[model samples]
Target: MTATAVQRFYRYHAYVYDFTRWTILRGRGQAVEQLKLRPDAQVLEVGCGTGLNFSQLLARLDPRRGWLTGLDFSEDMLARARRRVAAHGWSNVSLVCADAARMDLGRRFDGILFAYSLTMIPDWLAALERARTHLEPGGRMVVLDFGRFERWGPLGALARGWLRLNHVETRRPYVETMGSLFDRVEVHGRLGGYWFTAVGSNT
Candidate 1:
């Protein structure tokens, strides 16, 4: 999609972005917990909309040590995120507008996260690969998103339908595909069958 189109899609939702989506998307805290960063670790969050997860990360992080960076394609979302970061005086944090599928930041990170963002991205596989490139060796990457319902039993279909209403869907081939790059890949779900989390580390 054109930058304008992506902007238009998120612009209208930027104001109520966190509230509207938080109710349904789970696994964020778990995703953050899985990062397991070291003191002074460089961390990057992809598709960081409105700084929702950033706030959580900041709260759990020691600003005196680790560094945090957030990137998104939407200007509207980044604007709100900037306000949040500034309001909290989070000097350790930085925000940028870069496409998840294409970024040349000239740096690597110890941890990378995509919290409930893969499905909404148009070229998610490329984004995953790009994230892999940004990871330091032995670095961990985490993902949380709408999940496959097949394992959710009878309610699976209904849960997927609910996600569809919000323009989100699970990427089924995520683990099988990402395994080729990351030495280890584990994908799991929660929220009564609504969301998923994947963790991977480069060999």
Candidate 2:
């Protein structure tokens, strides 16, 4: 989908995004837990829609010392993220509006996360490459997203079609790509392989 289309798609969905996504957007908390963030770690969350992962990220990283940057292409999504940051009075969190595939923050980070975002990015490989460049040596990159269903049945077919309608392409080889880019890669399939979590290390 085009950038305009993506923005338009989230314009109104931003309001109900967190409420509805919590049920189906699984593995997010597990991904955050696997990050093993340092107290003063510098973390970047690409495609951080409405800052849904911010609270978990903050709980892991020390608020007074660590820094969390949330980046998204949709203005409407970021608006809610801004409100979340303000309402929480989180001084360490920052939000950026930019394309995940092409943004230079001018510094490397200790941890990078992509939460159910790669499927929506047409140039996901480019985004992953860029993320690798922005990771400090020995840094970790985490990915949690939809994957192929383990079962082949009507329900699986319907699920796949519904995801495609939402512009999510779950057929992409996310684990393979991460393995090729990082020194060490670990992956876990969950919900009967309907979702997956991948962790890649720059070491």
Candidate 3:
């Protein structure tokens, strides 16, 4: 989807995003925990829709000592995220409305995360490359997204079609791409291979 389409889509969905996504969007908390963020680490969350992962991230990385930046292309989504930040009193959390593929924050980060966002990106490879450039040496990058079903049966086909309707390209080789870009990469399948979590590092 183009940025405009995504924005318009979220304009309506943003209202119930947190509540609705909680059941289907799995592994986000695990992905954040896997980052193993340091107390003073600088972290970036690409496509951080509605700030769903903020609580988990803030729990792991103290706001007094660490900083978190959440970036998303949809203004509607970021609007909800802004509310989340304020409600939680996360003074150290920042939200930016911009294209993640081309965003340049004028600084690198100790850790970066993409939760259920890569498949929605048309130029996912470019976004991955850009994320690599934004990571400081030894920085970690974590991804949690839909993957091809391990068993492509009738149920798998139905699931794939349903996800496609939601603007998710489940066939994308997210793990393979991350493995190619990062020196050290670890991946784990989840939800019967319908989803996956990957952790990579720039050593």
> Which run of 10 residues does model 1 get worst, by summed lDDT?
163-172
Worst 10 residues of 3 by lDDT: 1-10
Cα distance off (Å), candidate 1, residue 94: 0.8
Best by TM-score: 2
Model 3 agreement with the true structure over 41-121: per-residue lDDT tens digits: 999999999998988888877778899999999988998899989988889999998888898889999999999998888
Clashing pairs in 1: none
Query: Which scores greater on lDDT, model 1 or model 2?
Result: 2
In angstroms, give how far residue 181 of model 2 lies from its true place: 0.5
Between candidates 2 and 3, name the one with more favorable lDDT: 2
For model 3, the stretches where C-alpha displacement exceeds 4 angstroms are none
Provide the clashing-pair count of each candidate structure: 0, 0, 0
Which candidate do you rate higher for lDDT, 1 or 3?
Answer: 3
lDDT of 3 at 163: 87
RMSDs, each prediction?
A: 2.1, 1.0, 1.1
Rank candidates, TM-score, best first. 2, 3, 1
Candidate 1 residues lying further than 4 Å off, grouped into runs, are 1-4, 151-155
Query: Model 3: clashing residue pairs?
Result: none
| TM-score of model 3 (CA atoms) | 0.96
Error of 2 at 52 (Å): 1.1
